[model samples]
Target: MDTLRYELVFSEGTDSGSSAGDVVTVERTSATGPGGHPVYTDPTGIIRAEISDQGEVRVLATGGHQDPAQGVRARPLPDAEERS
Candidate 1:
C-alpha cells in the first residue's frame, strides 16, 4: 500500500455564484502509473472539497490508497484570465 499526499491552491473568483468557503464535489478513478503499475484499486467516488478564505482549495483523502499518477485532477478553478 502506498500513501499519496497533495494540496491544491486557488487564486480567487473560482466559484461563480458560491462564496469562497464553499464545499465542492470531487472524484477519482483507477489508472496506471508512469511505470505501468496499478494506482487506484477502486472506482471513482465523490469527495467534498473546501475553499479557504484566502482562496485556497484543500482535499483530504482517508484510507491508505495509492493515487493515480495520470488521471483527472480535482481542484478549485483558478481566477479567470483577464480579458484584454
Candidate 2:
C-alpha cells in the first residue's frame, strides 16, 4: 500500500500559544480506527486522525476540547507532508 501522507490544521487552544490555523505534519501510528482505517498523529500528539481509504478524514482530539470526540473537523491534505 502506498504511504498515506497528510497534515493537520491546529486551531487555537488545541495547541497552546500557537496561532489559529497552524498546520503540522502527521505521521501514521501503529493504531487503527473504525474499519481498520489508518490512524495518524502529529508531533505534538494533540491531534489524531483516522483517514479512510476513500479519503475521508476523521479528527480525534486527544485534549483541549470539552468532548474529545467533537474534535475540529479537518480535510486531508494529500501529500502535504512532502512539503514539510
Candidate 3:
C-alpha cells in the first residue's frame, strides 16, 4: 500500500561494494491487533538478506513474535523512517 513503508539501513560490505547492505530494513504500518495497534512487522519476517548479482533478494534469517507480533513502537515520520 502507498501508506506502508520500509526503513532501510545500509552498511559498507567487504566485497559486494555499493549493492551490498541494501536489505537491512524495518517495515512500519498502521493496524488493529491484539498487540494494541500499529503492528510493526507481519506475523513472520526476514531478518537478514543476501542480494545476488542479478539483484535477487534472498532471505538469510527469519523471526517473529508470537504474542505481541509488533517489532517496534509507532513514532513520528521524521523521528522514524523517512520517505523522500
Whole-model alpha-carbon lDDT for candidate 1: 0.33
Best-performing candidate as measured by lDDT: 2
Candidate 1 runs further than 4 Å off:
1-45, 66-84
Model 1 earns a TM-score of 0.23
CA error at residue 72 for candidate 2, angstroms: 7.4
* Clashing residue pairs for model 1: none
Candidate No. with top TM-score:
2
Write model 2 residue lDDT over 1-84, tens digit each, in one string.
645556665465564655566676777888998768888888778767887766667776576644544334445555656668
TM-score for each of the candidates: 0.23, 0.56, 0.23
Task: Report RMSD for candidate 1.
Answer: 14.2
Model 2 clash pairs are none
Candidate 3's TM-score = 0.23
Q: Predictions ranked by TM-score, top down? A: 2, 1, 3
Please list the Cα RMSD from the true structure of every candidate, rounded to 1 decimal place.
Answer: 14.2, 6.3, 12.4
Over 1-84, each residue of candidate 3 has an lDDT whose tens digit, in order, gives 232433333444345445444433444445333423332343345443332222233333344542321222222223334533
Q: Residue 24 lDDT in model 2?
A: 62
lDDT of 2: 0.66
| TM-score preference between candidates 2 and 3, better one | 2
